[model samples]
Target: MNIVCIAWGSLLWKPGPLKLASGWHPGGPLLPLEFARDSDDSAELALVLCPGVPLVPTYWAYVDAPDLDTARAMLAAREKITPGHPESIGSIPAIDGAPVQQEIAAWLRGRRIDAAIWTALPPKFAGVGGRMPSAEEAVGLLSRLSGETRAAAEFYLRRTPPHIDTRYRRLVEARLGWRPLREAAVTCPA
Candidate 1:
């Protein structure tokens, strides 16, 4: 196949595909690329790539696709990105023709998968020099938030990997403390 869709987050596990893919690869860099960005649908923060930030351990998978347009359109729809923003889809340059999969791996090692999902939240994420709040700053932001916003941040933190950064984890846990909200009792509809 000459084209393939690269996945970094939830798309890694659950890819909403219109057609069955030919194959997939399990690739991980010692430090996965990650950046924090705002979400329109969930109304919370999302981990994406921000330019200039240190990368973290993460996974990216490549799915076989021979047709570029089909792969790009389907991946864009899956990401909920608006049409017309092909750059946001984050495909590598066409380069005349498809490069070998091994070459793709080399390119990914130095670049971040973080793309422009929601343009309103932050800037300088993709290249020209914008970056997300540092881990400490983000933790503080989460601490200040309440309700679903705070809860969502905590939930995502707990779910993601590279959590061994206890200092960062501690800040997030301490600032945006989380607890299960229990109902008065298990009251059933009569």
Candidate 2:
């Protein structure tokens, strides 16, 4: 069984807890690859974060492909759209092929799952540390999600902005309690 992890937002730059927890390395030189868009849209260049000498980390972007040829094709025709800069586009792999939900389910067994669900709140809702779900919250939410929803949510969280940073530490502290907030990496003043 194979599980695919798709990255979208900040995860594209700095992979969060999920990547770290999954034992995937973060930060490295990126390689340019071409990705095909829907239909006849022009191909875009994407920068894929390559780990050590070989072996790409599954946490970076996982997509189920029926075979190696399909995987190579998907990887070949991909593009990455950078945040705050639409013009700064590149190519990256896009997973599309046979249904691998069962494989994902089997693989998830006995494994720790860390996911971040993305939602669009008003600008005022944006705070520091971004909007990471608490450990309990993440577990609860993922427990009730369908495979596709889970996949989409993972992608969204990876691309979400750091709305929970220092600016609104006070509000978050008051809301979620100081201890958990601190432990969650969203520190606030005492």
Candidate 3:
């Protein structure tokens, strides 16, 4: 099967064990992406697909896996999602008729990609009860980060692909003065 992995966040820059047969290509699929998940690992508001939010462009790359299950497992491992929480990783052969999934299915059919997988971690904040954070709230969280945590967040924001701009990204840029690093210095953070 021609499986591919879609990404819009850290996976692009820090793909740990996802075997990519090719580099990321633009025009993957437009989804409602936002920095909504407060990640424990990165200590930043990690990006996630948020329903009803503005759709943003994403990137996709060919996975070296043999089938959808393998691809999903690889992505789950890369994202540190455990097996029990299978919902955290989304696959093209979805269970429900989610509009976003339908849109992605069409995109996959158009590209002749047999299957696709993506990080489907939900939006989470400390006291929000699973609701996504607003741009203002996200910036408030970022503002409170210090030391390496702050630097890592800044690095993550700067390293994201320019075309993956989302509402929260703009707010972070405006409020925290964090912009995408110049192309010449796009290397991973130290």
Candidate 4:
């Protein structure tokens, strides 16, 4: 059975204990990624896909997760989704639709890669009664943050997937009205 973990966020930069192979694609079907969720450990805003403007592009990486159950457990643990929702690993093309996922899937298969555990759970409800925040609301919340909280927010904005969109990045940066977080990782390297 094929088992590969899909990474479109921090996993792109830090794979944690999963030991995923090194390499990635500037993935597509730009999903509506937003910093609508709060980080329980860090107390800051983090990225999570939710229904919104499909502007942010996605990035994908093939990680080594030999066991399907283990892969789900690891991702759920990392994404902080406990008692994982009924649709945790829901379906591929599940959210992005068949065509988009098919394009990406076929591309991977052509290279002899099949992502059996394709992707992380959405961050929408990742938190305890967490609500997905809007771009404007996010910007407003960001504008009020200070210190480490603010830094954590910046790291999140910079690390998300596909590839960074400078326009949107600039918009977020402009909203915060502060210099971007120092060139540092929001998450530790594995």
lDDT of each: 0.46, 0.28, 0.80, 0.53
Candidates in order, TM-scores: namely 0.58, 0.20, 0.90, 0.67
Off by over 4 Å in 1: 17-26, 29-32, 95-131, 163-190
- Model 4, residue 75: distance off in Å is 1.5
Candidate 3 lDDT over residue span 1-190, tens digit each: 8888888888887789999988877777898888898887677678888888888888888899988778888888998889888878888776354234655777887577787888887799874547888788889999999999999888887888776788888989888898887761223222
Between candidates 3 and 4, the one scoring higher on TM-score is 3
Error of 2 at 175 (Å): 28
Which lDDT tens digits does candidate 1 get at residues 1-190?
3444543444543467524343334344333234355455553445554444444443444344456566667776777767655556544544235332333355455555421111112332223234555667666656677888666666555544432223444555566554212321112123
lDDT of 1: 0.46
Cα deviation of 44, candidate 1, in Å:
3.3
lDDT of 2 by residue, 1-190 (tens): 2323433233444433322223222221221111101111211111122112122212234334544333333433332322343222221221243223232334344654321111111111013222333334433443454666644433333233232223122232344332221222222123
For candidate 3, the per-residue lDDT at 82 reads 95
Compare candidates 1 and 4 on TM-score and give the better one. 4
Ranking by TM-score: 3, 4, 1, 2
How many pairs in model 3 have backbone atoms within 3 A of each other, for residues 3 or more apart or on separate chains, i.e. clashes? 0
Q: Which residue pairs in candidate 3 collide?
A: none
Once superposed on the true structure, which residue ranges of model 3 sit more than 4 Å away at CA? 95-100, 127-129, 184-190
Candidate 3 accuracy as lDDT: 0.80
Candidate 2 — which residues are off by over 4 angstroms? 1-3, 6-64, 80-159, 163-190
